[model samples]
Target: MSADYPSMTTAEIRSKFLNFFEERGLKLYPSSSLVPDDPSLLLANAGMNQFKEYYQGKKTMKEIGAISCQKCVRTNDIDCIGEDGRHLSFFEMLGDFSFGGVSKQQACTWAFELITKEFKLPLDRLYFTVFTEDDETHDVWRSLGVAEDHISRLGEDDNFWAAGPTGPCGPCSEIYFDMGEEVGCGSPDCKPGCDCDRFLEFWNLVFTQYDRQEDGSMPELPHRNLDTGMGLERMAAIMQHKTANYDGDLMQHLIKLGEEISGKTYDADDYSGASRSLRIIADHSRAVDFMISDGILPGNEGREYVLRRLLRRAVFHGRLLGIEGAFLTKFIDEVNAQMGEAYPELLKNVALVKGIVASEEERFSTTLDNGRVYLDEALDALADGAVLSGDVAFKLHDTFGFPIDLTVEIAGAAGHDVDMDGFTACMEDQKARARANAKGDAWGSFNDVWVELSDKVAATEFDGYDNDVIEGAKVVALVCNGESVDSAAAGEDVEVVLDRTPFYAEMGGQQGDAGELSAEGVALTVSDTKNHNGLYAHVAHVAEGTLTVGATVTAALNAERRGFLRRNHTATHLLDAALKQVLGEHVSQAGSLVTPEHLRFDFTHFEALSSEQLKAVEDLVNQQIFASKPVVTRVMGIDEAKAAGAVALFGEKYGDVVRVVSV
Candidate 1:
């Protein structure tokens, strides 16, 4: 460790990184919600997810540049957590971006200055990597005074970063810290590229220059954008002079709690299994605590399934330490206390988080015993070398909450191997079945046509919140069964894209507006509306005449239904306010749906709401309605609204401007 490097807490390290960037004129952006509103993603897996609209040209930049410490979770590395010293299910990413103002030169210069001058780390200990063929980044690193020998030119698989199969992508330059040769794999080629413990990569700087299309060809982006991410835990471990990320203050409190509960010491060389178990428990505690604080509950699919798996794994690992009977819930307080200052939501939802974890632990405890019995029976019936069926393993996973790792561990002890390929196939089949049965059905992925159309036309103008009838709206495009059509005749059900709409699309847990479109000789009934690539597509059934592209129509919302929607929408806000007043400030809306018949709200509460409590909430809402609390609605920027103490939904995506409702 360098003697000049000052020792700092994890929070301090995160603060220093953001402060350094903000001093250079970068606007600070708060971390976005863990749940993603994009249909392609389950969670906000990266800091750039919130800024994707700006990159794709659907929305303009809020600022020329921004800085943030984003909270992210990735389960693809879940299986590698305890086995390695650096993998974490939950971690903070300190990032700085330049939308179009700065170039790669300025980005490289700032990163180097902060690492060397601000943080006071020795320059000799740092190494850089760039794309093999990208002479631009290579030259920039060299211009920053990095030694030629200290920079490595690597291939696309190593230095290129992309969001997905097709989207914004660029070649990246990564900074690595040399931890020394003692931890190396004892090979001559054990450099930064080697997968060894000797070199630790801490930050990645991406120069977003290409817009990769679905056809595998790369075109230059409209503007050369810069995006960078530095792992907070990794940097903390280095500054704190710790060998492993979990050994630092970021996880020490939870690990100590694990030791106290299990009555065991964490010794890597003890071989008594205490060290591995402690690491697993400590890591999982953070993931589970943050997820529940964000209002996620234990369930069977999607983000819910991921949460259930994490909690169950933590409980099972507790069993390994000889700690049993819902002990994982006890660590919730420690998790909140350790990191709640930066994230107040953790403290607010502490009680509900503990409740959810305890309930899940209790449920999985019983399922474990039953799953063991089934596993033993299967092993006894199988021949000596026979493999376990994937269907059987998936049943234990889907029906019971048994992780496949446990099943594999038990089967391996009995001298048998699992058919992993079969298990994977079964898992895929289940996912497909679930998607087919979803409420959105196949319509969820019907946005490709709109993506192409958005390139030609501007986003749809929303006028429903202000006007009930939007006259002279032009029809932009039409689609029937995923295929674009020029015209749709009478009695044909089709999706219609318009230049301006008076219908509210399905968003923020609110139902879409039901309305009608009328022309001289044509009438169409819009059964529902959905937001696709910033365009509102009305799922309309034409009752008469052909609706053609480039034709004008008058869009009007059904007066009766619109009245019901307004009442239910206003009631939802009142109920939200009442829950905070009646229960506690910790209560927040988890999910909601407003239909003409009724309004449903799912909030963060540990236990079932009692009849009296339900009655109290109902009475308060009714009272507000009777008082006619002058339902106030205004259009303002998101920042102004938040500063005025307006409540923001947890998982809803808002634009630069938002609609604020108050009573």
Candidate 2:
């Protein structure tokens, strides 16, 4: 960084990226929730996550190109948070994307201009890395006047980009800045590709031009899309001339606040561990704040478990800072006050966020004491350099809510190492057991069959809100488990796909419709319907005759059951409104289930509802029913529905046109 360069905050850095792209005719899109709609993902790990369906041809892009600062959480490196200066559990990715609208030349040229001209960083300190065989990217850099020595061609592990086993993938080019030799590894070969901090990578430009097939072949994608990600915190760090990201303006304030709370100075010789703990607390606080605001709660599985682990880690580190009891709750307002302008959702959910954090802190304090005793005993049993058994560590985690990181930390202090491989095997065994015990066939795997089906099938059209009978509907496809079949005989259990139907697939906590479908010689009893990706799969069994493909069928929903479903669904809406009115705006739906038999609604509340409060909510819902308010369903854009004050479900994904249900 040059002393002559003007200082820029993280907010300003984000604005510059968005403004740069908007000026280039890219639409600005708001950041999506940290919780993703994709079942394969636990959290939105990248800026391109929200656009994956578009890349897979499952959903069409609403705009040709767009730019956004997506809020992302990546826990693969959770253990590296405080140890490394660059890794963060939560960070903002400033990105600009092209959906078959821009060429590589244009994208590369603009990235160069933004780095060199707008930010005014020295051009000589920058180096580029490309895939070993990607001569096109090499040519692009050369044509942009980059020196040959300043570019390095790396292998697939370093330069190739892929989302998963199969999807849109291609070669990527990364931009690294050469910090001074003081941060180098002293091998005399310090360059862009070195592991040392001498070269800090700030941006990655992914040319999504190929689709990686299941057979491990790279084929050309339908469109040459450009996906680029630049870390907002890293950019700020570079501009501020700081090697440690914690010293950057974006995090410095929080670090200072932590110092005030703990009464310990960061970077002081006597308090090195405390300094690291302070940094962890600051970083984890931001992640927890955003997660809770997204309607995630501390729990025992999936996304909730991730949140619980992070929150517990923050609490443990807070203890290391010498601040005892419920200290993390105080940082909620601090994070909101600092980042609320960029994300107003933080401010909107502040009250609920604080309450949840405080409760978790209080709950964990007791567990932390119990866990410490067990950890001490285990450490006492181990000699210097001895490894702790993974099963023991896992038991500490499972029974006492102890995190693996804390175990590793304590064991290291005693000069012992943790058997991470053993720990991983234990965790996997537990997950396998849980899956074996899981109910229903609802748990589906992401394989070639599912991906190909999603690409080949059109979205299922739904008309259950209006029509009870679906006439002239065709059976498009049928599946039995992972196998696709043309027809099914009597007593065969299979998943039937219809071209169009009046059945409401299970979504937004509403149960799937159970009905009957019949044709000239085919009849099937529908037990449940589900929106699998975009394909609505009717899980049914052939009761009377063989159901075959290309057969026109009359899909008749169970009218009495449909009425019960409607009443339950409408009551859910009423209950939602009544809860908000009685429990304050902090009441937001976390999960829901509506069936003819009953309706179950889970919401974000710090404590259990009182008897009187429950009665009030129940009375309010019944009063609406007795008043005989007409159920209104309006078709409009999602934005219009939101502006009209419709309550959006927390985890529900909506499309361009949404059906707004109102009482």
Candidate 3:
């Protein structure tokens, strides 16, 4: 709060941080998509997510070091976003990473220099905390001329960092800024790790030097790495001399838009009703915009559920501020205007963002009204201090599309608690019933048989991409009457798996190949080929002599049927592209089915296509087909394929190497 310290905008801070690292010889890497490619994460929660392969030794490090401003989404603190000064559902993590290239001393020194000289923070007010066991980090900070009293040593819980239960982990050193005694607890024990607004932790430097094994042993990594994350909003708040992150320039524009929409003013000093609602609206609008731009739509499960919750929470707060109708979309333009330069994806997907937000807003308007009535009735029926039953909560969610978090919020406000355990039980019960109804007993039994066979047989080798017939393929496993068998006589239905075959299994919405299996003394009629965790099962019935496991046979595919399937599958891709062109970029594939006869493509669209629009799509597809462009297929790394603009479905887990088809 001194005149000597220059106040900087959020954008300036972001630029300066990246430039500082770039000047130090770190290669700049663009932020990865919020929809993480890693299966373990629900969303990209940190800067290190994209560099996971480098740390785990799966992918070799190609650069000495790297820098990025990663856009991250964390919802565990969602319900508390507007209640404090620093929590956010979405934030940018300014990070610099090194894979066995930079030492801990260099990382700590550069971070200190960036904070004091580059950002011009008052050196006297900054405090550091090193892990208790990390003597190397402690000595490094001492060598930097820091007062010994200003640096604190904390325990593992406060200073240890890990990506998960196992994997790359290390001791962490944190930097905290003092906000003066006015915001402190006024206790003598107050320090950097205190849970108070007085000491704000803005950056964490993780020296990843160990690989934690499954047996709970921590062995030193062959090569040490450095990963650090500085929160952009936190830095902005400190640089701008603001007490709250929402008051910073990064979110002020969105807050101003909220005020204009609802005729309410945001009070930075107050963290109560109207002020809190304004802050939630501002924070959630940014999250909603970025999520939609990344191809995550509002829905009821997984990442979609996260987006829907954020959007609905913002909308609910708007209603609290007296906003009505579809007002959430009003913030999209402002979001794009403010963040478009740093993240051009926002600008490119403006129409899609607005369209989806508006549609969801319109849908939630009726849902909110209906859900509130049900909630009020339930709350009224409940006695003071009595918990709301999960059955009623589930009813509200199932019948009215009300989020459970929203229900918990309302219940808490009324001085009541929810039966979360009961709620979880109810949810699991519903999921179990739905699974049983969808898969049926027969399929369940078939899956159980496959599970047993998987232990005895390795994955089937797929040769169907090119060859139509595989000779001398040995049968590895056989199943008859929903049980594994060594042999199946003639006239009995069975499923067989060969060590290698030329049969295409059902995958990616494409129907399986129809073929035949024959040998010197046996024959089987193949009806469908199914993939079971990489094992190809040819569903068939013995027509001639007995077929036994380990029997060498000829696996032949029906080439004519496969040709039809190939054409239909190709049409689906063309149809997908044409729909996007004719409708909008928001048209993402929801589901699909490709068969030898015809194909079904399901997608996300707000409205029905008109006859003229449908005609345009048809014409486009026909034009592509008539042009006779060569279709090329090549296998490449996932990153390379993405660089080539190969479209990927959201939530689909892809391997390192992918087969990409270009038409």
Local error of candidate 1 at residue 354 (angstroms):
1.7
Candidate 3 regions exceeding 4 Å error are: 1-3, 214-216, 376-394, 397-399, 403-566, 585-602, 607-663
Task: Write candidate 3's Cα lDDT for 1-663 as tens digits.
Answer: 333588999999999999999998899988998987565567898998877656755344567799999999997778798988888999999999998889999999999999999899987888999999899999999999888988999998999987567767899999998888888999999999888789899999999989877899999876898999999999998899877788799688888888898999888888888889888988899999999888788888778988988898888888779886788877888888889999987886787788888888888888988999999999999899999999889888777778787798899999899998888899889878855555222112222566556645788988778899999999998988777889999999998988988998887788988889999889999999998656799999899999998899999989999999999998988999999999988777767899988999877676678999999999999999999999999999999998999998643558899889998
Per-model lDDT: 0.83, 0.84, 0.86
Checking candidate 1 for backbone clashes, the offending pairs are none
Q: What is the lDDT of residue 593 in candidate 1?
A: 91
lDDT of candidate 2 over 31-82, digit per residue (tens): 8899875566788877887776556454446566889899999987787787
Clashes of each: 0, 0, 0
Better of 1 and 3 by lDDT: 3
Q: Which candidate would rank higher by TM-score, 1 or 2?
A: 2
> Candidate 1 — what's its lDDT?
0.83
Positional deviation of 35 in candidate 3, in angstroms?
Answer: 1.2
True lDDT of residue 282, candidate 1: 90
